[model samples]
Target chain A: MSVLLSPERVEIQLGERSYPILIGNGLLGEPRHFDAAPAAASALIVSNTTVAPLYARALRDTLAGRFQAVHMLELPDGEAHKDWQTLNLIFDALLRHGCDRKTVLFALGGGVVGDMVGFAAASYMRGVPFVQVPTTLLAQVDSSVGGKTAINHPLGKNMIGAFYQPRLVMCDLATLSTLPARELSAGLAEIIKYGPIYDMAFFDWIEANIDALMARDPAALAHAVRRSCEIKAAVVGQDERETGLRAILNFGHTFGHAIESGLGYGEWLHGEAVGCGMVLAARLSQRLGGVDEAFVQRLSALVERAGLPVVAPALGLERYLELMRIDKKSEAGEIRFVVIDQPGSAAMRSAPDTMVREVLAQGCAS
Target chain B: MSVLLSPERVEIQLGERSYPILIGNGLLGEPRHFDAAPAAASALIVSNTTVAPLYARALRDTLAGRFQAVHMLELPDGEAHKDWQTLNLIFDALLRHGCDRKTVLFALGGGVVGDMVGFAAASYMRGVPFVQVPTTLLAQVDSSVGGKTAINHPLGKNMIGAFYQPRLVMCDLATLSTLPARELSAGLAEIIKYGPIYDMAFFDWIEANIDALMARDPAALAHAVRRSCEIKAAVVGQDERETGLRAILNFGHTFGHAIESGLGYGEWLHGEAVGCGMVLAARLSQRLGGVDEAFVQRLSALVERAGLPVVAPALGLERYLELMRIDKKSEAGEIRFVVIDQPGSAAMRSAPDTMVREVLAQGCAS
Candidate 1:
């Protein structure tokens, strides 16, 4: 049984670049949802091969009424394909079709599609307008909402990108029904992230409604997506370029990125690594006198309950340290991490290698 | 004889992102020129093979006092190498050296190196502080002053890039002494541009000093670089994103891009194509009754005197139209040319195919 409700909107206040994140059921295939898009003669919907087979026609048909010409391009699926080569596919298609600066691009599918398309729009002809139509839970609540668009380098995740915001983000709740269970858990990791860094109450709510969220309950999912976007939007609005406050959003990313990089990206989903990374970062936070052991255990239990991996892969401590030293947040080869300074607060700080090694020894599988 | 004088500064008044363009003799090897650069533990000087042998060491040595560690990377020379692969080399070096987000990047070459490095700094870890040390006259006068950085795609020149500004632009007039005569003329092509689009007095001054400029007279060169930067700074300060007025700076670029793209990039220098493109664009302006025949002839004579090709490559009418249609300014497959509306004014507008074809027929080589 579907719980019918009006679409919820979260405004990301980025001055001239501000846009809205719309969350609702059956929003796709609805022409009204895309009315905020800039007037253009052409609209290109860039989706992944996996997502295109499911929802491309609905989107193209919906945009047809507004744009004189609507086109679709499908890139190969997954994080493995999120590189310059895959990004070039979008540019290649745009050039082939003679898409101009006014031509808007719609990013369909998950984080990979959203990121690559967002970057394509950012770099194509200096910059062009693009909209995010997030089809996965990870994208809807996290990647799609932020203007942080990038592609992975062999050396680092999001090593190449731009701080370019999308004109609008459409989160169709209906798309979640098709997401794999593993991906749903991964999305929960990012949802769980906002709580420890910015809002303990939201964290408490996530703990309480964890089961309902897993069941794809529309009301529960809607609440989770809206709250996550609200907190993220508030943070991003204040510091769009991650000068200071924005780094807090990357809470589990330092360790998560290491795990992803150590094992090679795509070995574990970004959210899965973040889920486990949050647990390790929490333990590190406790050791650094920011939190208590009780808080760390409580967070770990929630990450496991959400079905994300609690144990990081057994990459050597040296490799973990090496990978993290190259993190975007690192300075002068020193790894700076977003650690829980308090129950509802986070800050970027550096810990000694001894403490980091101890956490890795305890957190990684032998 | 050397014209020793105080460094002339042209402040590009872009709020917050604003920076100064410093012009004078021997500014490159002086540490004082880089004082405005952000304090960082490391600095990477990215140049081309052709330029690194001449100036990389002096730049690195000067930066050594400011940054704890100074690095150098020399890319392959020429416009042919301005692609994603070359851009990635900068990323690879940064990551390899464990350079942090705070690491400063110095773009220490002509437009190709500057464009690639600027784009690299703009994208690396989202963004990093970079300074433009333009060695070529073209770069000093045009490319380096504006934050228009990009790498050429197979389909178009600068199809992928960002409007990221540099912290400082250092135009060492002394470096122009080593510039090849052909490249020197290419630089004059840009200097000639500002006069026709925004300032007729500057055009008049240029006509009076074209011989001195080609001869590399220190006083004439300094005035040319400074005045060109002033006109550019005024234009860019008002329209940073090329939304309206900034497009005027590209008066010769639409036809220039087609010429470059038609013959393939690197076949002729960018300024050479632009030089000829201005001649064609001026003739088009005459056809549209925006300017008289005398004005076109004046511009054409000036271009020829500058040692740039006045005759366009005979790429054929259909190919020219096809190439122009894919230009970034084109909308809905219609080409928009930045034509001279009056003697010292320009506007972007589309012309009849017959008219464009007629100009192409006469302008191109037999």
Candidate 2:
């Protein structure tokens, strides 16, 4: 059966300027996928040491046929290396291989690779064209869709970056077959985010089919990836730079980033951090009169079902408080959280330390 | 005579997405001036050790009254120091002072400080609201307005950064009063860039008043800053990410960056390197049929008039070609130059090394 997907392309209308994010299957090998990118120049593929082994050859094999040349720059995997020292690999490869402003950089890995490649494209001789070909479910569903490109610093995660949207985001569901089960679970936390922040019904659907998703069912995964991209594209299209509506998309990120920063990088996957963070935010929401006990329980059950860490790791209350205050969402050192009154509805709000501490203590109870 | 000569504020209209460029006198002390920046929950001011002592106090004193509270982070001075290690200083300062996403950052210094501070602000917790309080001429007129914030790398210049915009760009012409004459001349290189790429009228104005500008005449300086900012704002507003029209803004940058990269940072001022680069670009432009001997003579005359180097530094022609190819702008190691077809019109083009060598050789003749 030769099925046709609408490509469900969303244009991030920046007026006389805009870009598309394409979501579907078997996209990597398709020539039509990159027609929007600059055709007169070379294309650079920046993938991780891991992802390159699986998909780089096919991507290069595809682009090399049409473009003047195709080259690959393999970066070491993990969040620890997503800093200046490691990002230079792309530059070193670009220089060694000879890529220019017209050179289109394809980020063919997960969040680490996509963010690094995106930022590299953003600052490479001021900026260059980049396309997102996210392999991991987490990146396909979130990081690759938005224009937010950045690198992690020692003091914080994603501490250096820019709001540079890709020329196109090609999300091929077929790639997820190779993702680790733990990573697949981690990606769900963000997918679950869309349903709660904007579509309560979508959350309920995931609630019912959590088992099928855990098995990496293609139909289920495609639906989740396509819908998540739809929601993200819609939010980002309207508020591309998170000045307003897009902030809601960070439903659990304010809390999630705190946990990630508090524990240090690599100890927990980004999704794992958000999974635990959502629990605390749910509790805080209940106290603030934004969300009730039933809502908290509903979300927690989903977190647990997704095979994510539902309970916060035991870092002392002071450290938790200190870390949360250092969050990008904090103002004047005041801790902020993107809280939900109910599924599909969210708000960015500030909370006092006393309430946050109580939620932290409750989060550790499990 | 209480003559209030506003530095002709230019409105860079991107609709509801538009921002103002404040080009005038003693704006730091004016209470309303700080209001140009939206009231954020928190704010951080990123300045250099040198600029901080001179102006950070006034900035903090002003922003403290507006933002939730002001946090100050001081970094070292000079291009050599504007790297990840220096950027870590801002991140460390933010974490130590407990800044969050709601915090707005104010970049209070020249290009080195502005680029690093803007980069720190962009990467701090993914992204944050930043204001550009540019002190030097190069920054006040060019880097400060374009949202092209970055730092030089061990391998290349601006290899790490983002196309992150500032909420407001406050160019206090008074700050230039303290800029050393050599530094002032360095900035004039960028001032000369506008005349050739997009504004011949401004170029002629610079040619006419070279002496007053060299003397750091406030009126002449303010005029240059305002006109340059307007040209930059128009270009950036049309092409915020250097996709097309914005590339023209890099007229002298390709050659300038190679010199900076070859000699290593801080050996010569960025404007000085650019001053030299513009001369080489002019010669290259003449070779490629984009410019005439008359245009080259005008550029050389201006560089000489500004008391800046009008020839490529003796870093070896082979080294120059190799370094230029590794720049963020180079693709597949093929160097691209933003050459003028005529004064006020520029384009990114490729040329032969044989021709470039002739230009390199011309530098030796001098």
Q: What is the lDDT of every predicted structure here?
A: 0.92, 0.81
Task: Tell me the lDDT of model 2 at A332.
Answer: 65
Q: Per-residue CA lDDT of candidate 1, range B186-299, in tens?
A: 899999999889899999999998899888899999999999999999999999999998998888888899999998898888899899999999999999988999999999
Residue pairs in candidate 1 whose N, alpha carbon or C atoms collide under 3 angstroms = none
Model 1: lDDT of residue B55: 93
In order, the candidates keep a fraction of the true contacts of 0.91, 0.75
Question: Which sections of candidate 2 miss by over 4 Å?
Answer: A1-40, A287-298, B1-8, B13-17, B24-27, B62-64, B193-208, B230-240, B243-252, B284-302, B327-350
Q: Scoring only the second chain, what is candidate 2's TM-score? A: 0.96
What is the interface root-mean-square deviation of candidate 2? 2.9
Report fnat, model 1: 0.91
The residue-by-residue lDDT of candidate 2 on B244-323, one tens digit each, is 78888888888888888777888889999889889989889999998899889988999989989886778888888888
TM-score, model 1 to reference: 0.99
